[model samples]
Target: MDRLPRLACSDPRLTRLIAIYETLAPATLGALEALFAPQARFVDPFNDVSGPAAIRRVFEHMFETVDAPRFEVLDAAIGAGGGAFLLWNFHFQSRDKQRTPRCIQGTSHLRFDEQGRVLLHQDHWDPARQLYEGVPLLGGLLRRLREHLAAR
Candidate 1:
């Protein structure tokens, strides 16, 4: 369990959205429409999509690829103009039994419609280091490349 940061100004919509994310599951994906507008745009390292249906597909693929995928909201804040930001960690295990569990720290910027449903959702995270760098062979190559590219 993660501790939620105290919000300076509590927005019910943001609160509810966080709850949805923290408890999100395959069965509960249908609830996305309640949090996202019909034409909401969602973008991440590997996906750029519009509309709730497409967003749902992205999440569905996550479920298909990983075991017990979940999100822990570490911190959140509501902007003065109905926008919001969420800092979170995505936890999951690879379907491959040999791979250990993994966590990806990320942040999301969200803009809401007048109705409090999200219009835009953009995720910020580094997949090269957080994801690809964990592969056996590629990981070693990437690590060596990072070392060579290091400033100091």
Candidate 2:
């Protein structure tokens, strides 16, 4: 099993981003029914969903495959210089019975709505290195490289 300590959902900005991810990961449609702006849009490598319902659906799909997932904000910087950014690491196990937990890094660029809901969320990460390569022998190699990169 793998664990990534979650962020404290106290600061309003971090709270919103954390809420979006949590509701998405577990497909907790009800939890997000009123959380987003009616015209909000969310995009990622595998999903480009608009409006709350569509976003909820994308999350539902994610829950089907990802198991026991957690997203941790390793660090964050915010100021008038630009929008807030969270340096995050995502960790999860696959639903595949034999798989171990997988970890990946991403940078989340966030903007708040007029009401402080997360309006735009752009995630930057490489699916090829973070996810696709996490399969068996290929995964071993990726893991080795990832560890090497981390050590540096």
lDDT of the candidates, in the order given: 0.87, 0.70
Off by over 4 Å in 1: 1-9
- Local distance difference test, candidate 1: 0.87
Using lDDT as the measure, the top candidate is: 1
lDDT by residue for model 2 (1-152), tens: 24446554456766666655543545356666466677777788877777878877766766677887776777666648446788777788877878678888888776667776656667888986878676779888887788888955
Model 2 gets an lDDT of 0.70
lDDT of 1 by residue, 46-120 (tens): 999999999999999998999989988888887787678888899999877576899999999999888888999
Candidate 1 scores a C-alpha RMSD against the true structure in Å of 2.2
- Residue 96 displacement (Å), model 1: 1.5
